[model samples]
Target: MNLSQNLIHEIKSLIAKAKEGAIRSVDHHRTVMYWHIGERIFNEEQQGKNRADYGNYLIKYLSEQLQPEYGSAFSYRQLELMRQFYRTFPIANSLRSQLSWTHYRLLLRIDNEDKREYYIAETVKNNWSVRQMERQINSQLFERLLLSNDKESILAVARNEVIPTNPNEIIKDPLVLEFLGLKRESAYYEKDFEQAIITNLQDFLLELGNGFSFVARQKRIHLDGDEFFIDLIFYNRLLQCFVLFEIKTHKLTHEDLGQLQMYVNYYDRVEKVAHEKPTIGVLLCADKNDAVVKYSLPENNNSILASQYQLYLPTEEQLLKEIRREIEILNKNDE
Candidate 1:
């Protein structure tokens, strides 16, 4: 190409890159600005201790004056949200530009600090969108982790750079698969459920939680001149490992665990790179007994897990009862 032509191409590329960067910078500035505005509003609101009603009135008056000048961005609800946003994240420097205003709004709704921080770290680390963050929070991701890990370990995972060192750190014992939209009593084959997971793969991966990316479905493996097919394969970027899944529509059995172990061994020996961590295996089934899972696997079983999958969203009462039961178990064990 001629020098002038090359120069024009380079100019166009630079312009496009600059425009992208400018847009990102503007968004970052806007996020920080809103955080500061929230802080100011919260401080002012506290100053009127006796007139508890003053905050609402002030927001209304501000909206009236700013709406025409600032457009919908300065609406009463948005300003109120900004105030709450500041209350949620008191430190301005903690505001992450990767998370949009919508994400902060969702985070503010979570009352527990530990849970909120867990979601924040996971969202930023996994690059989750606002919708994904909301879904995970609603699904009780923190509670699930707490159930699977000790208090100190769970808190450490939530608060620090220490990535999960074992499969149990990231795996949920009973995975809620309501996102698949399968009817509760639907007479579906295991293959059907597997196919649905593959079809709605993106949603499934989100439901699977952080670090998971689809690798293959019904992946073929050859062993000792014989062939076997693995149901689903995923690679978790956070764990730096491959995940092999076997789907079952019935109660879990020792054979199922044995089969998964073999697959895990095969992947670790033949498929896993030298630098990568050990391969993890999961048996996703309809129902599982903790005792069965415990006795079936080896004493130091960290690479293999058995998790139950639900077809429908549990009732609120049932969910609450389950949470209570989990808490009770933890309390009893503590004694």
Candidate 2:
């Protein structure tokens, strides 16, 4: 580029960076301001601790006094949120500057301390936007991860204390695909579903978990004049392996697992380097039977997995049921 063009580009980049930095600075201060407000309110409430309703009365009174002057930002509800925020995260230094007030507001909804910590670590680690974090929470990402993995290991991975070695550690089962805008009632061909994933690739990646980069769609291979195509391929930097996906619009069967296994074997033999791990084969089916999945693969098999996919986000009832079922399976295994 010419000197003038280069100068203009440099100026634009500088201004953009400055604007982003300023926005971050403002957000950080606002978050700190709310924490202080919460702390002060808590201190005042402690003085009147003898009265059962003093905390409520204090917040209501403060809201009335501040609302008119500060507008609805100081509403009684918002103040209560601030108070709860402080109670939840008492250590001021523990608050992450990378998170904004909105992020904290969403987090404040979670009552489970362990769940809260996991989300906090994941949000910061992934640099999730407020909306992305909300979607993840709504989809019950933490609960889903807990289905196959233990809580301690999950938290350890989220906190970066140890790298994820197993595919199940990072891959979520029953992948929620509400963002694809595909109707649950509508019948979609495998090609159409694949196309939708590509169209909404960004959201797909977030839902897929961390360290995944899209490689190819309908990745073709040949074995002695017989050709095959894999639906989707992704390389996970964290796992240091290729993740091959086969989309099954219908219920999963042993045949589906066998097909994906063949593809995984091909990648491992031909594409995987010496330093890389074995390729993981995932059958992204619309439905699955856990028993069939279990018996289809060898008892020691670790590379092939069957994960069901839902076109819509699961409701709270569904999430609770799934969690209960997963817990039951774990309990049965222990016996």
Candidate 3:
């Protein structure tokens, strides 16, 4: 390239970096300002309970006063959201710079502290845009994670207070495939679904949860004279192992589980390092039988898991029901 061309490119890159920095600075300060407003309002509300009670009147008055000077951003409803933002995240020091006012506003709606904390940690870890954050919340990522594991363990992992010790710790049941933009009415093949997942790989990785990176698609495996192909391969740095996924367009069967087990064993014996943990295999199917899943695997099996896949986002109630059902079973077993 010519010197002039190179110079122009360098200047453009520098300008882009500066613009990004300026945006971050504006967002961080805006978040802090909202927090301060929330803090002051909360203190006033506390004093009101002991002395005078302004209640809704105070918020309305502040909105009126602030809007005249600060513009429409400080409207009555927005002010209320800021107050909630402060109430939900009491400690100022805990706020992340990467997140903006919009991020906290969405987070404040969650009544569960552990769920809120998990979202915060994942938001930062994933560097998710505000829109991505909203989608994840609406999809009930926290609640879905609860379905595959104990509530306490899921909460602990989400908060970054504890590392995942096994595959189930990072795995989620009924992996949501809404991002793939596929309709259920049309007849589909496993490769079609696999291709869709690859096309929307970024969203797929997010749906797969944290610490996942794509390794291969239609990954080949050679055992003696026979050659086999796995649909998808992902490596989880947190789990320190490769995660193999096989796509199935129909209900899972015993033979399907056996195939995945073989893949897991192949990866463990051949691909995995001695220090790394066992490779985790997921048989993602349209449907699965719990009884078949239980009987197919050994008594102490953690490496292979059967998870159903849905083309649409799951309702929060659906997740809650499953969690409650699992908890009830555990309680019964305890008794």
Computed on alpha carbons, the lDDT of every model, listed in order, comes to: 0.83, 0.93, 0.88
The superposed Cα distance between candidate 3 and the true structure at residue 125, in angstroms, equals 2.4
Give candidates' CA RMSD values in order.
3.6, 1.6, 2.4
Clashing pairs in 3: none
Compose the digit string of candidate 3's lDDT tens values, residues 103-183. 888888888878887788888878899999998998898888777676688767766778898887787888888888889
State model 3's lDDT: 0.88
How would you order the candidates by TM-score, starting with the best?
2, 3, 1
Per-model TM values vs. the true structure: 0.83, 0.96, 0.91
**Any runs in candidate 3 off by more than 4 Å, and if so which?**
4-14, 44-53
The best candidate by lDDT is 2
- lDDT by residue for model 1 (264-283), tens: 99999899998999999999
Return the candidate ranking by lDDT, descending. 2, 3, 1
- Stretches > 4 Å off in candidate 1: 1-20, 158-160, 222-226, 237-240, 268-278, 312-320, 327-335
Candidate 2 global CA lDDT score = 0.93
Please give, for residues 1-335, the per-residue lDDT of candidate 2 as tens digits: 45798889999999999998899899999888899999999999999999999999999999999999999989999999999989999999999988999999999999899999998999999999999999999998998888778899999998999999998898889899999999989988999999999999999999999899999999889999999999999999999999999999999999999999999999999999999999999999999999999999999999998889998778878877888998888889999
